[model samples]
Target: MPSSISVGREARKANRRLSPRAMFLREFFRRPVMVGSIIPSSNRTIRRVLDRVDWGNVRMFVEYGPGVGTFCQAVLDRLGPDGQYVAIDTNPDFVAYLRDTVRDPRFSVVQGSAEDVESIVADHGHESADYVLSGLPFSTLPPGVGDRIVAATRRVLRQDGAFLVYQFNPNVRNFLTPHFDHIDYEIEWWNVPPAQIWWAWKD
Candidate 1:
């Protein structure tokens, strides 16, 4: 049997794993626009988003602004081996961290803008996505950027696909309503700051 000293060393190694919340704070301080939230999303918020996914038929899923991958892991946990999960983030640090940490064959981490969803999906050899989850701070984005992202999301999603977005405020509804045919909204107050989830889809 291993000695107590060796067991203690193994325990310490496990505890050294990087905290996504700490990473979020560090990145937010460096680039508030890119990082968005001061802290990583809570499990409540993540569950709310994941619950909206139609896991049975969802072959391709895209995540916008997946900072430190709070939702990424949840999605991967439920995504099948044949399913494809692509995460796009403009922050290089978050991208690198995700690439190094998330080890799933169905996962791809791209360092790019959410506005490029169409081309990014094409580059990955996927025609369109079944679901697109956005963790971006649309309300805080510059004029027209949020609109462009919403438009791009609409363009890249399949006819039956869904666009799921969680925002600190309801301001993004204006941008989403014009692009999607139907919209459903729900509020989850268990998060660090209460969040509103919007599920939009075309007829």
Candidate 2:
């Protein structure tokens, strides 16, 4: 997703594809509960997440379920000098691999559930994040788990913070509706099976 790292339109477009060395599907198995993708079947949405965010105004950011760190690179590129990236995923294999794949000193990868972000960050000495982006598949979560994660996110996101979530299903609106001050969608016409982007900002 780091478009600048690989110049040229063709290369940039190609860069959007999953990394050849990436263990995307295998990593998904590490935490079936959080992986939105059925693996190879839904990998395209991961690339879409990288292509849709505002590069500026992003300092300290957190990413949930950053499988293969596709969006992680884009976020780090846009981050300010003191900017830091904290990525949390339920997949331990992914957390390990993603950590090793990134070369930035400012990036931190955590192998844990998204529901524990606040505690995880506290351990790392970060109070709350400027932006929190999530790729967790919320539509099918067990009843209270979805709400619990949202509440945890709200606690870790500053008042001016922005949180972005990408889902293949529109039902996500229900989980976010009562909690967020704003919820909007960005549609991707060509993504495999097509998809919707959900943007949530705190009041």
Candidate 3:
């Protein structure tokens, strides 16, 4: 019936269904513009991005494009008992994976655009998020989508809240500049491709 290559492809697809890394690679190939890297973020990058948050005062923490729950457990671990962690992603596969694997009452995964963060937060019974994390590839997003996401992110954050972003491209800074008065960044060289971590405050 099938050729060797065809069988290999099918076998890999099956493996992807069972393996998180394989699934992430599949999604990256399926949507390179949406996924920043084929490899998941490193633990060092996760710590650098998350350390920017003031966990004690955080009531709600929102995330954009949380591929394969990389930061979910970390956020949940640091979050207060009463805090909420809501993650939004356009990738159905990622949203589904997070929903199926992350079994925390405080976490909510929505298959949607990051631009709708404001309404999404409202829908979840929160007025504003204390911190929002995103690793979406802003430099690759479709025209106008990046602008909308940054603008809406600013609107959905509390007064002292910050937007935490880790990206391979430093160009994401351009998208953040107009919305945030204060922005700082560092490079986490320990990551696969080395990531630029940013903190854009809503001051």
TM-score of each: 0.89, 0.78, 0.91
- Per-model CA lDDT versus the true structure: 0.86, 0.72, 0.89
Query: Which should have the higher TM-score, number 1 or number 3?
Result: 3
Off by over 4 Å in 1: 1-17
* Residue 116 Cα positional deviation in candidate 1, in Å, after optimal superposition: 1.1
Candidate 2 residue-wise lDDT, 1-203, digit = tens: 65744455444344345472347755556556667665432445645655545556555688887777767656776677777888887765566566556889889988878889899878777788777887778876778888888889888888867678877788888888878978777877666556788778886
Candidate 3 weakest lDDT stretch, 10 residues: 8-17
Residue 7 CA displacement from its true place in model 1, Å = 34
Q: Which candidate number would show the highest lDDT if scored against the true structure?
A: 3
Candidate 1 lDDT over residue span 1-203, tens digit each: 99988976564344336687777788899988766778877898889877967898888999999888889878988988789999999876777778778888999999989999999999988899999999888878889999999999998999878899988878888999889879989999998788888999866
lDDT score of residue 12 within candidate 2 = 31
What's model 1's lDDT at 189? 92
Ranking according to TM-score, highest score first? 3, 1, 2
Residue pairs whose backbone atoms clash in candidate 2: none
Model 2: ten consecutive residues of lowest lDDT: 12-21
Better of 1 and 2 by lDDT: 1
Q: What is the per-residue lDDT of model 3 for residues 65-97, given as tens digits with 9 covering 90 to 100?
A: 998888888899999999999999998778767
